[model samples]
Target chain A: MEIRSMRFKANASAKLADAGLQRNLRKAKGKFVDTRAVAIKEIDDFEGTRRAARDLRDRVLKDLDLWLERFETQATARGATVLWARDGAEICRHVVDIARRHGVKKATKSKSMLSEEAGLNQALAAAGVEPVETDLGEYILQINDNEPPSHIIAPVMHKNVEQVADLFAKTHHKPRKTDIPQLTREAREVLRSHFLTADMGISGGNFLVAETGSVALVTNEGNGRMVTTLPKVHVVITGIEKVIPTLEDLSLLMRLLPRSATGQSISNYFSVLTGVKQPDESDGPEHLYFVLVDNGRADVVGSEYHEMLRCIRCGACMNHCPVYQSIGGHAYGWVYPGPMGSILTPLYAGIENAVDLPNAATLCGQCSAVCPVLIPLPELMRKLREEQVERKLRPLAERLALKAWAWVANRPALYALGTWFAVRYLKWLAGGGDRIRVLAAAPEWTAGRDFPAPQGKTFRELYRQRQP
Target chain B: MRVALFVTCLVDLMRPRIGFAAIELLEAAGCEVVVPEKQTCCGQPAYNSGDRASAAMLAKKTIAEFEPFDYLVAPSGSCADQIRTEYPGLLADDPEWHGRAVALASRVHELTDFLVSVAKIEKIPGAFEGSVTYHDSCAGLRSLGIKDQPRALLARMPGVELKEMTGADECCGFGGTFAVKFGDISTAIAAKKCDNVVATGADAVVAGDLGCLLNIEGKLRRMGDEKTKVLHIAEILAGDA
Candidate 1:
């Protein structure tokens, strides 16, 4: 979550891309962008749906407290224990306390990023219990011990099948197997045993349906179902922002989530778990606990970034983000990457700690345009930059440059003169070539690029001539 | 229609031909074009660099200069997109400035986009005998949705072959201050863009924003592939296509 050397690594990655074709990013550049293109073409009114979903979320955030209360009340009355946690430590302690009280030896988990954020596995392990991941991606990432997850949807996106096979080899104590099918089959076999023997089940809530106190999980894998049904105790860990006022409010999000995430018309499984199983039910967790972790949502409640809480965790913003496509999430140096990560990481962690988030975007507005719930990501980034400046976090040179430009810009004559002189100086520097062959300290342009001086005149000069 | 040109700082300082190209092309399509000397940079650099007060100062200056025009047009898609999409949000703090920012933002347009979408220009008077690839600037393509306007004009050029480049919509690494602050990364992206242009084997690379063109063109020079020249879309549309 705290990446000290992210900017350094990002700079290094950039250097590599300049030195070569950037083979690592290129391998998926064609693949990810192209696949998304095909997938986008398949959805009719995808843009329309995007706008509607954005509007829906805007409406939701306008009165977040009302929705959250409605959800908690409904869920608590539905035979489920609803717990509120203001921070990760609290959430971890709560979950651990439950396991300790129930004497839980092993727990099967269905890929919860919230769990990852809460550091559930480590706490559970310290309490002498094992929390085994069941979702294919999370399970893969967990066994590898590389880190938590780079992507919200694709935890192991950085890992290819080869690395996965290697991870399995070390874990299973066998020779390396490179085949994709073999790797998956081995994981499936290994997880199947855990599911059967697990005393408790843990899963992240996709949507906390307020009307029925029911939690809806949309997963491609059936692991979630097995985790919940096979265990005596089921725990649904989610953010406070995941609460929806009604099932109807949640239905709109259901349509937007899958299409935005993996481009599916509908996920394979849409499971709705309401509290615990009934008395007459043959199978299902007898005890159910819903843990709502604030993490940092409360701080942003009335702040300018409250809309960020409206995120449904679909990973749409990340998938289409240009920056994420390049460094492939690792460079974000945070659990989340891309547009959402850029905005959220700094807020979740401290801005001073994650100084790079504000600078991550190109300010292209693509993230906002594609955002299902219209979060003004670029604008938010600009605000973060302002926060940095207000805090005096940026270098004095950059701040002074802005101040000087501001003073000159407010005056027409000075701005025009400054423009004229700069252009003339450039022309003189280029000396009839139109190309500045050599550039100074501002070598960012000249380092790997060049600046073309206009042919004898600047646009302002030409316009002045036309005016005269 | 009477139109006022907001020639961006890069276009003004680095490439004046893009301005001429825009003027000639717009005039050829039958619109009265005026270049206002009172205009300055769109304040994107300061704005993006977290100087809101300065950005607001520049935004106020821009509003004062261009608010009376029928429409404010710019050759760069990135600048036009900024005026339309970002200016209002940036100035929302001051209610009076907010209205002015919104007013100025609403009427601003990218040159080719204005020429097509508003003025309804069918063809520009131009022809060039060469194959060229077009790089879709991120702000223009994604921000303003000026996808077909530039391409539509290029596709209809008389003698030019409008070949497509791979990853044409990717950033050219000229992200204002991003170029300087994050140089190593910006150059890498620029190198990728240069390769796409070279891969097309086109004589020139064309784009809506001069900023992107300059970045790509510079990389082409550093990479020692001078055969691939960089041209603004307006220049190509203004020429003998």
Candidate 2:
């Protein structure tokens, strides 16, 4: 995916102007936030579970090499082939080569953010193999000229039922059905045939168990199962950071993952695939392949940002963010949006160009509070901002202004004298009005609202006068 | 307890009444309150904007100024938050200031928190209002855990009828410098916040921090809502009972 993170402010303004998008996003924001809160309350020892999950993830990241080697050995022993690709291009090359080897003309895919990161569909298409999306949300986006998923868990969260109905009517050449069940039925009918016909199946693994050599696929719909099972060749594309040391760890995280994302006590389908179908087994893929992608995970692992690798891609942080709630996903202009996007976009896309991603947040801490893995999101953002300052990426005028303010703030007499004069100057700027119409150093502050005029004596002066 | 009032720079300049009200509330709660003449801004504007050096300088100055007191209380939650929660982190690497910063941070409290928790005040001797709604400033609510304290204080007022507003805990978009930097987005958020406050049809909107009150009040006035009064929680608590 292209790094459009630099255009965040402009994109946010454009998104803010779209009332329809605002309405839909606001509704989703409330629903997701409320449901997540309720879902969390229903679980016993939820915080304890979250702590255990965080510890396990941290343990896995600390020994990523050992885990990966163990996973490769175990998975290979279980008759599944594992390949490690350092970057997206390499991952794409391997996928294309595998598709051609299998004589795959068409492949059915479940929702895989890793594949999106790898641009596998475009790679496959260039290699003369078609990709069919089996997940209903992914299918809707795929049919609509391959629009990127607005959300991680819920691909078409930005789209209302009416919009989906219109798109389905246009794409399927049928009458529009605004009802959700009808829409699902129509999508299922269209996708079922593709699943049967496609030669290869591509899906993302939620968790890679190092001990068992098993990949956990968590989904609310049956399509994830179909995409992995129906095709002749099944390939799992996922980030290298998705590995866990044991199935015991996976069980604890799965407890929080579904609850945190979509607010379900448990997802409908939780499939654990150990390897390919045995010779005696009737209905499963003959070949199982794992593409463990490391676009920048290796670098982030030992760095100060190793904690970010703990993310389960739950989308809980985004679901709970106030800034993300105000501005929809497209405003972020990336594959990821909200709090996780603010952190990941800069790391993955290049921090120099993606500086605005860190600053977009108001440091509300809701994302941090809701995170199942307990990523200190605000602290990470603050550290990123500090890096930007050190790199001199901040504007010179703003930087100079901050330095000047600090200089004044460092000295009590200077701060007192400066503010005393500033108050009087601001009052004069008000021109005998209740609110200041114009001011130096800040025109935007007075754009929509007036700056409240300061009153008579500064508190220090008042306190001195009132001394008995 | 001898409390040193860190009347935040905003309350000191734009609305000294809030400072005086804070003093009155503290005095009524049986604490000896003193205003430290050397104290100025809390350096949150610098800290939040990623200028740790400036924030560190101000933190040192603040720590020195309030070092003599048994307790340091601020009228603004944000200022208190900066002093109490952030100062330790800001000066963590400083060999000279780290211990002092941590010491100051431990004794610091927001006005309502001090009144309710430390002072252990069962009732305040002042109040007057119609149906009043309270805005939970982000720092006070999230940082200081000060949601119920002000409301608990207000509950003591006989004339004041507390009406809850939607999104009371939502940020009013006065993120210190954020309002000036991203004015359009700030104004949009403030406008939405003001709309929620207005929806309650309350006679006045009150909050623990002056920054939020000013932002929400400014938006309300801009939207021709001059009649809906905006007051700091201190003012309401200090009003005649």
Candidate 3:
């Protein structure tokens, strides 16, 4: 996808003004938040599980190469081809190469963020092969001029039912269905033929178990099963960080993923695909391939951001994030969105390219509090800000202002004098009113809300007078 | 106990009464309170903005000034959190300062946390006759585990009724500089917070941090809600609200 993270401010402003997007965001936010709360409450030891998951992820990331090689050995032993890609372009090349070798015409795809990262659909189209998104959300986005998904889990979360109904009517040339079940049925019926006729299936692996060389695909809708099983070829496109040491670990993570994601104790379908179809197997893909893409993920290991690699992509962070809730994912302007996206977009896409992504968050700590794997998202963002400062990526004015504030703050007498004058000046600006209706220095703040005028005196001044 | 009150820069300038109210609460809890005049900003703006050098310089200064006190307390949870949690990490590379930072961190506490846990005050000196919905400022609620301390303190007041607001623990978007940097999004987030605050129909909306209170109050007034009171926990506990 195009990296428009540089335009975060403009994108956010446009999104905030979008009433329809705001309504969709609110509705989706309520559902995701309420369900996850109930689901988490059901767990007897959610914290302990989170800790165990973190340890497991950290252990794997520590010896990531060993785990990946083991996974390759096991997968190769089962007659599945495992390919490594250094970046998104490499990933596209591998997938397109595989498609050409297999004489594949159309590929049915389950929702995979890695593919979105690779721009795989566009690449396939350029290679003269068709890509059909089977996930209902992805399918909607695909039919709607291949619009980039605003959310990782719910691609069309920014769109309301009315908009979807209108789109379906225009695109499908069929009667519009307003209700959800009817609309879902219409989509399912439309996607059914594509699923059967597609020459290849592509999926994003939630976790690749090294012990068994199985790709664990979890989805609420049955699209994952169709995308992986119905076609002649099946290819798994995922990040190298998705590999885990054991199936036992997958069991623990599986318990958390669905609950943290959509609040289900378990997804509707959980598929563990190993290698190709066995001789006795009647219905399975004839060819199985794994494309483990290491696009900037290797640099993060052992770095300050290693914890970010532990993300299960449950998206609980974004669901609870107030900033993300206000402006839907597209404003983030990348494949990834929300708090995790704030970190990933900068790391994967150059930090200089997406400078605004890190600064955009309030460092509220909600993202860290709700993360199933316990990634310290806010802390990571703060570290990213530190990186920005070191690189001089932040605006010159901001750096100078902070430097000036720090200089004054270090001198107690100067700070006291500064505050004393500043408070009085602000109070004067209020013109005896409790609130300052206009703050010339901060037009951004005054654009929406009034700045509360400071009290007439600084606390230190009042306290000194009260003494004796 | 001799407690040094780290009057956060915001409390010092925006609403000095909160600082005075905090001193009142501390004195009522049987401590000799001293306002360290040398204290300025907690350097959160610098630290959060990624200016580590300035943050460390300020942290070192704060540690030196307040280390003499038996305990150091702050009215704002964010500043207390910066002192208690962030200072050590910020100064980790400096051996002498890191040790001092660690020592100071041990004595640091947010006002309500110190009141309920450290001071163990059984009776409240201040009284309020109205109901209030509490806003859990982000840092205090998540970083400091301050969810129950403030509520516990409020419960001690005889006539106070606590009405819980929905998503009380969510951020009010007054994330220090975040309010001004991304003011539109901050306002939208604060607008949602105001909706929850107003929905309770309580006499007032209260939080431990003045930053959040100011944002909520400012946004509430912008939304034309002039009636719902926004207050700091110190003001309510000190009978200054």
Write down the TM-score of every candidate.
Answer: 0.93, 0.97, 0.99
Ranking by TM-score: 3, 2, 1
Better of 2 and 3 by TM-score: 3
- Candidate maximizing DockQ: 3
DockQ for model 2 equals 0.67
> Candidate 2 - CAPRI tier?
medium
Q: Per-residue lDDT of A226-273 in model 1, one digit per residue for the tens?
A: 998999999999987777766787777877777667777678998988
Candidate 3 lDDT over A1-468, as tens digits, reads: 789999999999999998888888888787888899999988899999999999999999999999999999999999899999999999999999999999999999999999998899999999999999989899889989999998889888899899899988998899888999999989999899999899999999999999999999999899999999999999999999999999899999998999999999999999998988899988888899999999999999998999999999998999989999999899999999999999999999889989988888988998888899999999999999999999999989999999999999999999999998999999999999989988998887888998988888988898889878
- Model 2 chain A worst lDDT run, 10 consecutive residues: A432-441
lDDT measured at residue B139 in model 3 versus the true structure, 0 to 100: 90
What are the TM values for chain B, all candidates? 0.96, 0.97, 0.99
Candidate 1 residue lDDT tens string, B169-240 = 767777888887776667776877788889998988888887788788788888998777778888777772
Question: Where does candidate 1 stray beyond 4 Å?
Answer: A1-24, A30-44, A416-421, A424-438, A453-456, A462-468, B93-96, B121-123
> What does each candidate score in C-alpha RMSD?
2.8, 1.8, 1.0
Candidate 2 C-alpha lDDT tens digits along A1-468:
777888888888887888988888867866777788899998789888888889989999999999999999999998889998888898899889889899999999988998888788889999999999888888889888988888899988888888888899999999988988988999889888888899999999999999999999999889989988889899999999999988878888888999899888889999998888998887778999999999888889989887999999999988877777778777787778988988888888778878787887767677888899999998888888888887899898988999998888677788888888988888888777778766666888778887888876687777778898
**DockQ for all candidate structures vs. native:** 0.66, 0.67, 0.89
Restricting to chain A, the TM-score for each candidate equals 0.91, 0.97, 0.99
Worst 10 residues of 2 chain B by lDDT: B120-129
Model 2 C-alpha lDDT versus the unseen true structure: 0.86
